[model samples]
Target chain A: MRVTYHAVYLFLAAMLSTTLFTALKLFGVSPNLFIIYIVFAGFYVSKTEAIWLGLVFGFVYDIIVGANVGLNGVLYMFACFLVVVSCENVIRRNNAVVTFIFTAVWTAVLEGINAIFGPVSGVWPAIRIIIVEIFYNGALAVILYLALKRIFERLYDNEKR
Target chain B: MRKLFGNRIFVLLLTITISVSVVLGVINATKTKSTFMGNVAMVVITPLSDACTWVGRKVSGFFGYFGDIDELREENEKLKSEKKELEAKIRKSEGTDRENKDLRALLELSEAYPSLELVSAEVISRSASNWYESFIIDKGTADGLKIGQGVISGENVLLGRISDLGSTWARVTVLTDSGHSVSAKVIRSGDLGIVEGDLSLSKDGQCRLSFISKNSDIVVGDYLETSGLGGVYPKGIEIGKVIEIKPEVQGISQYAIVETSAEIETISKVMIITNNPAESTAVGEE
Candidate 1:
C-alpha cells in the first residue's frame, strides 16, 4: 500500500476512535479501531513500516485520548512488533477467521499490557474490558479487513502478493 | 536474525523512542499541569474531535427529536404547573428581598463573598480512555480558563475542574474521576466530610463522601455542597445529594453515596468559573 493510503486510514481510525467510538460505548467499552488498524498494517506492510505506523498512531491516540502520554504508543509499538514478527513465521492466510483470531489475540495482549500499566479500576473491570475489546475489535477487524483487502486488491492487483 | 540486529540506527531509534515514551508517560501521569507535547498534540487533535462531536450531536439530536415527543409533552405539562407556583412565590419574594437588602447592607455579607465569574463552554468530547472520567471543552487558555477552574451545570451544580488545556481546548476532570477529591459538607446537618471518586461508583455517576463522623445525623436525600476548604474550587457550589449511607468496614466512620442533580454522563454544556473565591479569600488573608 502507498503511504498516502496508509495516512488516510490512520487519520480516519484516529478520528473515529476518539469521537464516534467514545459516544457509542457499550457497558463502558468501545471497539478499538487502532488495534484493528495495526492488524491491517502488520499483514500488508514491511516490519519497519508497520512498526513506524503503529508508533505514530499510538502516540497520536494517546495525545488525543489520554492525559498520560506515551502509554498507548508503547503498547501499540509492542503489539505491532509481535504481529509483524508472527506474520513472518506464520502462514499468510487471507481469510476472515484468521484475521479475527489475529486481532483477538493482539487485542487481549495490548489491553492486558494497558491494564497492568494503566489506571484500571480493578481486576474485574480490566477483565471485562479485555473480553469486550477482544470480541468487539475482533468482529470489527474481520469486516474492515475484508473490505480493505477487496479495495487494495482492486486498486493494485499486481502489488498484492 | 543477524541482519535484524545489525541495523544499529534502527535499534538506536527504537530504544530512544521507547525510553522517551516511558519518561513522558511517567511525567504526564504524575504532573498536574499540561506538558508541552501534550498541549501541542491537543492543539492539533482538538479541532478534529470537536468537529466530529458537533456532527455526532447534531445527527443524534435529529433522530432523538422524533423519539422524544411523548416525553417532552409530559415534561412541558410539569413545567407549566411549576411556573405558575414559581410566579406566585416571586411576588412574595420581591417584598422579602426589599426587607433583606437593608439587613444585608448592615451585615456587609456581600463583602465577605463575591459572585462567581463564569464562562459558558460546550463539551467537545469525552475522555476516550475508560480510566479517566473527563471531557474536553471548546474554551481554553484563549478564553481565560485556567487550570483548576471549576466547571458546573447551568444551575450551579459542581461538575469538575480544568485539569489541562491547550490554546483552544481544555480538559475537565469530572467529580467521578478517581483522582478528584474535594472537601464538602452536609447542608442539613453541617457535618463536614471529604467527597472523592471511586472507580466502582464512578461508572454509575456517583461519588462518595467519606470520613463522616459516626455520630453525625446524616441521611439519604441530604444535600452536599463544597466546604471551600480546598482552594482549587469555590465555596457553596452544590456537589450532589446523598443517595445512600453506609458504615465504614472498620466501624470507625461512615460514607454516603452522592448522585448529582444533573447526570454527568449526559452533560453537553457547562459553565466554567474563571475565578476561585477561596483563592481570593486566601489572598485577602495574606
Candidate 2:
C-alpha cells in the first residue's frame, strides 16, 4: 500500500517536473520538488522507505530530464543515504533547523555533482548557477515543509490503520 | 544472514544504480541513441506528460491565447498586405504567365525535399532548465515521427528537429539549447557556418553562427537558412537573421549572433516532417 502510494507520488512528481514546473520559474529556477520529497522522506520516514523513494524517484528524474540515465539515480540515492544516516542519530528533535540543513546539504551535493559533470563552458558559470539554484530551493523549502508535513501526516495516519 | 538478507535491499539498489550509471556513462561517451530505453521511457512517461501539457496549454492558453491571438492576427494582416502588394506588382509585370511560373517554382521547391506531408502536433512540455532546450510533442513513433526528423513552425521557418521518439510522443530539441548545433548559411553572402545555441543568448531567443570563415562578406541584417548538410534539417528553411557581428581580427569575422525567427518561448504548436523525398519514394514502392 505504501509502495503504491509512493509510486503514484513519484509519477506525479515527474509530471510536475516536466509541465507545471516549466512555467513556475522564479530566479530562473523552480524548486526541485523531487529532491524536496527525498529530503522529507529521509527526515520523516523509515530508513528503508527513504532509500527506496530516493532510488525510484531519482531514476524517474533522470529518465524525464533525458540526461544520462543513471546519473540522477545514483546521485539521489546517495543523497538520501547520507541525509538519513547523518540525521537519524543527530536531529531527531528539532524539525525546522534539521530540515533547513538537510535541504541545503542535499542541494549542495547534487548541484556540486552537476557542476563537475555538467556540459557548461566553465566551472565558475556552473558554480554561479548552482548557488542561485540552491538559494531558490532553500527559500521554497520553508513553504513546502508545513504543507508537506500535513499531507504526509495524513498519509502516515492512513498507513497506521 | 537473515538480518543481512533483510537489509540487503539497499545493497541491491546501490549495486543496480552503480551498474546502470556505468552503462549509461559508456552510452553517453559513445553517443549511441537510446533506441530501447528511450522508447520505453517515452512510452511510459509521455502519455502522462502529454496529458499534463495539454491541460497546461489549454489552461494557460485559455486566458493568454486571447491577447496572443490578437497580436498574431495583426502581424498576419501586415504580412498578407505586403504579399498582396507584391503579387499585384508581379501581376502587372507579365499578367498570368509570370505568376504561373512562380507558383510552379514554389511547388517544385517543396517537392525537392520530398516530405511535404507534415503531421501537426501540440507541444505538451518544454525542457524546464536553462541547460537544456527540448519539448514533448503529442505525436510519436505511432505517428511516424523518427529521430532526427525536421520540426518547423510555419511553411518555411526552421524550428528544430525531432531528437527522441516514443510510440505516442516525441521530444524536440529546439535550436536554442546550448547543446543544439546546425549547419547553416547566410542567405545574402552565401557564407556558411555551424549555428549553435549559446547558453547566455538563448534566454533572449538568440543563437550564434560559429566557425564562419574570415573572408566572408557578412554583416548585420543578413538572413540564414539551413544548409541541410547534417541531413537532419531540410534545406533552405529560414532560420533567423544576423543581429550582431563580432570580429576575430582585422578583415576577419569570428562569429555573428543570429536571432532565431521562431518565438520558442511562447510557441505552442509545431509540425514534424516524417517523410523526406527518399522515404516517400520507399513508401510509394512498398
Candidate 3:
C-alpha cells in the first residue's frame, strides 16, 4: 500500500499545526502556525485543495480560539486564496531559503492584516511582535523545509522500488 | 462568457464554500451556543493536549531543576525576610484582633454572597495546537465541577472559567486567552473597569485593563480585583496590579497594564468557584 500525496500533505499539516501549538504553549508565545501551514499548502497542494484546507482549518481555528465566531475562518480563507492565486506565476521550487522567505512574507501579511482588523489591542506593540515572530517563524520554516524535503524525497525514492 | 463560466468550477466551488462558511459563522456569532462547537472541538483535542503538556512539563522540569537552585534559594531567603516584616506589622497593629473580627463584616459590604464550595484541581493538560487557548483540569463533572464555573488561584486571583466539563476532566479557558475579559475594579478605590487579555501582552506575562475613565486615579501597584458585575466572578479577589497606565489618545478611555497575580507558567493548584452569588446568598442566609 502506497501513501498518496494527499495523505502525506494532511499528515504533515496536522503534525505541523499540533507541534507549533504545543511549542507556543511551552514557550508562552502565540504566533500563527495555521498561516504557515496554509503557505506550505499553497506551495505543495493544488489550488482547489489549498482552498478547502484553508477553509477547514480556519473554521476549526475560529471554533477553537476565536472570541466571536467566523472571524478567523474568514481571514484564513482569504489568506489561503490569496497565497494560492498569487503563487501561480512563480516557478515551483522547494528550497529551504525560498520556503523561509515565502513563509516569513506570508506570515507577516496575515499577521499585518489581523493587526489591523483582528481583535488586537495596542497596535504599536503588535508591530514589534510581528517583526520578531516573522524572524522566529522564518528560521523555523527553513529548518522544516529542509527536513520535509529530505523525507519526501526518500518516500518518493522508496515508491520507485 | 459561457466558456468562462464553464471553466470556473473551482472559483464557483470556492464561492459556495466561502458563502456557506460565512453564513454558518454568522449564525454562530449571533447565538450563545456558538461556544458549543468550541467546547466540542476542545474535547476532541484533549488527548493530544495532554500528551504535549506531559512532554513540555518533563522537559521544563529537567532543565529547571538544574538551572534554578541558586535562584530558588535566593527567593526563599527574600520570602523569609518578607514574612518577618509582615509579622512585625501584625504585632505593631494594636487593633489587629478587632480587625480580624470585622473581616467578614467588610466582605458583607460587597453584598452578602454564597460561600463557595471549592474543589481543588491540578492542570493536567495544556493546548497542543496554536488554534485553541485551553487547559485541562483533573476535576470534572464527577468532582461537582460544571461548565461556566470560575477557577481561581491560591491567592484568589481569577484564572479563567470552566468551558467544557467531561466525566473525569474539564477544560479551562485561561484569562490570558485572547478572547477573555473580566469586569474588574481597583480594590483600594472601587474604580470599575474591564481587564482583557492580549495575545501580544501574554509574551511578557501581562494583560491589559481598558475602558477606565481618564480622570481615574490609577497608579502603578494599585491592586485590581474582580468587580462581580458580570456574575461570572466574585468581588474582591485579587486579579493583578497596575504596572503601567497609558492615557487615551484624544478623548479615548485610558488603558493600564496588569501583571496577573497567578503565574501562568507555574500554576499547580486551582479552586473552582461553583457557587453563583444567589446560591451563595442562600447558603449565607441558611
Candidate 4:
C-alpha cells in the first residue's frame, strides 16, 4: 500500500522531468528528480523498500524519457543501496544537509552512468553538464528537502499504523 | 544455501547484477524499436506532455505580454514595411509565373515532384537527459509517419529523421545527435560530404561535415543540403551553413563545422514529409 502511494509520486516525478522540468534546463541539463526521490526513500524508508522502488521507478523513468531500459534502473538501485548502507554505517544522520550532499553526489553518479552508457563522444562537455546538474539538484534539495522529509515521515507513520 | 538466501544485501546485489546484465543484452539486441513497455508509457504520457506544453506556453505568453509591447511595436513596423515589399514582389512575379507555367507546359515537363503532403506536428517534450539531442512529436504511425522519414521545419530545413514511433507519437533524432548522420553537399562547389553529429560540437549546436577530400573546394561560408544519396531524406533540403573547417587527427582529410540553419532550441513545430501521399490519412480528412 505504501509502495503504491509512493509509486504515484514517482510517476509524477518522471512526468514532470520530461514535461515542465525540461523547460527548467540549466546549462543544458535538468536535475534528476529521481535521484532526489531515491535518496529520500533510502534515508526514510527501509533499505529493501528503497531498493525495490529504485529499480522499478528508475526503469519507468527511462521508459518515459525514451532511453535504454535497465540503464537507470540499475544505477538507481545501486544509489539506493549505497545510501541505505551509508546512513546506517557511516553518516547516521538524516538532515537537510545530508539530503543536499547525497543528492549532489548521486546526481553525479547517475549522470556519469548515462554518459558511459549513452552515446557521449566527448568527456569534458559531459563533465561540465554533470557538475551543473549536481549543483542544480543539490540546491533543489536544500529548498525542498525538509518538506519532503516531513511528508515521507508522516506517510510512513500512517503506513505503520 | 539457506543462510546465503537469507542474506538480504547479498540477494539484492545478486538480483541487480542479473537484471543489469539482462537489460544490457536486450538493449544490444534490439536497439531500433521501442519496447512494449515503452509504447505503453508513451501512450499514457504523451497527452499529458502535450497538455503541459500548451499550458506552459499560455502562461509564459501571459507573463510576456507586459514586457513585449515595445518589441511588438518595432516588429509590427518592420513587418509592415516587409509586407509592402513582398506585395510589390508578388505583383511583379505573377506575370512571370504565368509565363513560366506556359513555357513549362510547352516543354512537356511535369512538376518535378507532386506537392509535398506534409504532416505538421508539435514538439511535446524533449529528451529528458541532455546526452541525446532528440524530441518527441505529436504524430506517429496513425499519422502515416515511418522510421527514416525526414522531419523538417516550416521553412523546409531538414531537422532530422524519425528514429522511433508509437501509435500516437514519434521521436526525432535531430541533426546534432551523435547517432545521426546525413549525406550532404556544398551548394556552391557541389562537393559531397557526410554531415554527422559529434558530441563535442553538438553541445554548441553544431555538426561536422566529414569525408571531404583534403583539397575539396568547400569553404567556411558554404551552404549544405541533402544530397538525396541516402534514401531517408530527400534531396535539396537545406541543412546548415559551414562555420569552420578543421583537420582530422590522422591529417588525411578535413571536416567542416556547419551551424544548423534552424534554431533547434526554440522550434515548436515541425512538418514530416509523409512517405507516400496516398498513404497519408490526413487527421481530419474524410
Candidate 5:
C-alpha cells in the first residue's frame, strides 16, 4: 500500500475506534477498530510494513486511551505481528474462516493480557469478558475483512493502472 | 542466532516489544499521564481527539434519533407494563395527600443543604479503552473545575469525578470505570459498603459494593447512595441498585454488584458540583 493510503486508512480507523465505535456499542462492547484494521491490513501487506503500521497506530491508540500507556501499543503490535506471521507459516489464505479464527485468537490474547494487567474481581468474570469480546470482535472482524478486501482490491487495481 | 538477529523485522519487533513493555512498566510505576511523549502528543492530538468525539457523538445521536422498530417494540411493552403498575399504585393512593407531603419534604431538603455551585458542561469524548470507563467533558480549571469534584447526570444521580483536566477540558472517569471507588451505603438497611468499579462487571453496566459485613441486613434490590464517608462524593446521591451478590467461602459477601442509574453513554450534558457544600463547610471551619 502507498504511504498516503496507509496514513488515511489508519487515521480513519483511529477516528472510528475512538468515536463511532465507542458510541455505537452493542451489549456495551464496541468493536476495537484499531485491532480490526491492523489485523486486516497486516494480511495484505509485507511483514515489515504491517509491523511498522501496527507499531505506530498502536502507540497512538495507547496514548489517546491511556488506561495503561504503551500497553495498547504492545498488544496491538504483537497481534499484528502474530497475524502476519500466522499467514506466512500457518494460514494458506485470508478466507472468512481464517480471518474469524485469527480475530478470535487475537482478541483472546489481547484480553488475556489486558485482564492480567487490568483490575479484576475474579477469574470467571475476566473469562466472561474475554469470551464476550472475542465473539463481538470476531463477528465484526469478518464483516470488516470482506469490506476491506473490496476496498484494498480497488486500491491495488488503481495502483496497477 | 546470527541470522535471526540479522533479520530487520524481527529485530524491530523485538526492540519495540521490549521498549514498549519497559515503557509500560515505567509509566505504571510512577505517575499517571506524566510521560513526556504523551504530553507532547497532546498538543496536536487533543483537538483532533476532541473533534472526533464531538463529531462522533453528533453523528451517533443523529442516527439514534431514528427509532429502531424492535427496540421501540420492546420499550413499548416495558412501558405498558410499567403503566399498569403505576395505575394500580395511583388508584391505591387516591385518598391520601401524598403529593403534598412529598413536595413539602422536597422543599425541606432544598432548604437544608447550602447552595451548591454547579457548572454545566457537555460530554465531548469517551475513553479510548473499553477496559476503562471515562470520558472527556468540555469544562475545566478555566470554569472553576478541579480534581475530585463530583459530576452528575441531572439532579441526584452520581456520574463520576474530574480525574484529569486541561485548561478548558476535563476527563470524568465514570463510576463504572475500574479502579474507581465510591463510599456508599444501602439506604434501606443503612448497611455501609464501598461501591467500587470493577472491569468484569462493567460490560453489564454494574459496579461492586465491597466490605459489607457477613451478617449485614443488605439484600437484593436495596438502593445505594453515597455514604459521604470519603467526603469526596456528596452524601445521599443515589448511585445504583443492587443487582447481584457474590459470597466468599464463609458466606460473607465478596461484593454486591450494583447497576448504576446513569446511562453514561447517552448523556450529552452533565452538572458538576464544582464546590461541594461539605467541602465549603470544612473550608469555612478552618
Candidate 6:
C-alpha cells in the first residue's frame, strides 16, 4: 500500500491535539482538540476521509485517555459527518469570523451531547462550563485554522507552480 | 446506487474499526485480569504523556522566567524565613518527641491493622483531557499493586482504587470522578451511605455522599470513612467530611457535600492497600 500524505497529516493532528490538551489542562481548562481537528478536517477533507480520521483519532484518544469505550468515536464520527454535510453547501472562505462561529457551535454541540451521556448535575453550571470551554476552544481554533490555512495555501500554490 | 457505493473503502474501514473496538470492549469488560492490556497501554501512553508533561513544564517555566526580579527576591526571602521556621520546628520536635511520641500517630495506628499493606507510589501523570478522569502512578504490579486495590493518601484518606494494573504502572480513578463509587459510613453517627462523585464538585475539591438517611443525624462537620462493605476498600479509611447535608424533598435520603481530606490535585505520594482481608476473602472464599 502506498503511504499517503493524508495519513501523515492525521498523525500530526493527533500529536498536536495531545499537546493542546496537556497545555489547556495545565491552565485548569479543558479544550477538546480532537473535536476541533475533526471539525476542521470535515470542512477541508472529504466526508469519508473526515469520518475515518475522526475514528482513528477517537480510538487513539480512548486508549490514552480512559473514557466510556466508544463514546468519543461515536461523538467524533457524528460531529464530523454533520459538519461535512453542512459545509458542502457553504462556500469555502478565508474568513476568521466564520471559523470562530463554527468552532463555538461545534464545541457547544459536542458538550451538549456529552452531557446527555453522563450524569450532569445542575444544568446551569453545566451550561456555564460548556460556554467557557467553547469560548476557550473557539479562540484556539481561530489561531490554529489561520496558521494551517496559510501553510496549506502556500503548499497548494507551490504545487500549482 | 452509485453514490451509495462511492465511499466503500471508508465504510469498510469504519466497519472494521467499530467491530474491533466492540470486541476489545467486550474483552475488557469480561476479562478478570487487566494486566496484559494494562501493561500494553502503559507502554504505549506513558512516554507520550511524560513528554507532553515535560513540554508543558518547560513552557510554563519559560513564561515564568519573565517575572520581576524584585518580586522574585521578595519571594526568595519569604521562603528563607519559612525554611528557618521549619528548621526550628524540626529541632524542637526532636527534643519533645519522646514525651508525645505516640500522640496522634495515625501512621502507627494504621499499621496495627494486619489486613492493610501500604506501597507508596508517585503520581506520574494526570488525565490528559477533560473527557476522562484518571491518573497514572509510577508503581504498578511490580510494587504489589493489583487491579481493584484501594489507594489512599495523607493520613489514610481514600483517594481512589487501582482500576488498571500493569507490570510497572497503574491507573487510579480518583474519588472525585463520576465513574467512581464507594461504600462509605458517617464516622460520627455510624450511618452507612454511598459516596458518589461529581466532577463539577471538583472545583471546590470535594466529593458528594448520596443515599444518606434523612433521619440520620449527620451534621455538617461529621466525618466520613470507608465502610469496607463492598470488599473493595478496607473499613475506617477516612474519605471526607460532611460539609453540607441537604435532605431530598421526595426521597427518604439526604445528599451530602463532602470536602475530601486528601488534596487530590496536590497529592504526590499514594499508598496502595495490597493485603486487604476483604480482597483475600473474596478471592479465597470464591
- Provide the TM-score of the second chain in candidate 5: 0.75
TM-score of 5: 0.79
CA lDDT scores, all candidates in order: 0.75, 0.70, 0.64, 0.77, 0.73, 0.67
Best prediction by DockQ:
5
Looking at candidate 1, what is the lDDT of residue A86? 64
Q: What is the TM-score of chain A in candidate 1?
A: 0.89
Candidate 4, position A69, lDDT:
73
Is model 3 an incorrect, acceptable, medium or high docking prediction?
A: acceptable
How do these models rank on lDDT, best leading? Answer: 4, 1, 5, 2, 6, 3
- Rate residue A97 of model 5 by lDDT: 77
Model 2 Cα lDDT, one tens digit per residue, A1-161: 66777777787878877777666555445568778778776765666667667777787776676666667777788677756655555665436555666787788778676544545655655566667667767766777778767666677763321
lDDT by residue for model 2 (B54-156), tens: 6665455455446468896786688777797775575466435543553454455445545466777777777754466788888987888888888876445
Query: What fraction of the true interface does each of the listed models get right, in terms of native contacts kept?
Result: 0.40, 0.32, 0.19, 0.50, 0.59, 0.16
**Superposed model 5: Cα runs more than 4 Å off:** A88-92, A153-161, B1-12, B15-19, B34-75, B78-115, B252-254, B276-278, B281-286
- TM-score per candidate: 0.80, 0.77, 0.70, 0.81, 0.79, 0.73
Query: A1-161 in candidate 6: lDDT tens per residue?
Result: 11254455555544444443443342345676676667665666667666776766676656556544455676577567657656665635535676678778988876776665545666865676688778887887888887656655554453210
How good is model 6 by TM-score? 0.73
Q: Which stretches of candidate 2 lie over 4 Å from their true place?
A: A94-97, A154-161, B1-22, B35-38, B58-115, B247-253, B277-286
Q: What are the runs in model 3 whose C-alpha is more than 4 Å off? A: A1-28, A31-34, A46-89, A112-117, A154-161, B1-10, B13-21, B34-41, B61-114, B124-147, B163-171, B198-200, B210-218, B250-255, B281-286
Per-prediction CA RMSD (Å) = 7.6, 8.5, 8.3, 8.2, 6.7, 7.3
Quality of model 1 by C-alpha lDDT: 0.75
Which model is ahead, 1 or 2, in terms of TM-score? Answer: 1
- Cα error, candidate 5, residue B279 (Å): 2.3
Clashes of each: 0, 1, 3, 0, 0, 0
lDDT tens readout by residue for model 1, A17-108 = 66666656666677888888887667666767767778887887787666657777866776676576666667464568878998999888
TM-score attained by model 3: 0.70
Could you give candidate 6's per-residue lDDT for residues B1-286 as a string of tens digits? 3453465654664465556556655664565554444368666656665565556544544444453467867876887787978755655675355224423343553455545666777666676455445677888767788888888873667889887767877889888877689998887789999998786776556888988777888899999888879888877788888889887777778899999888675455677788864644221122
The complex in candidate 2 yields a DockQ of 0.31
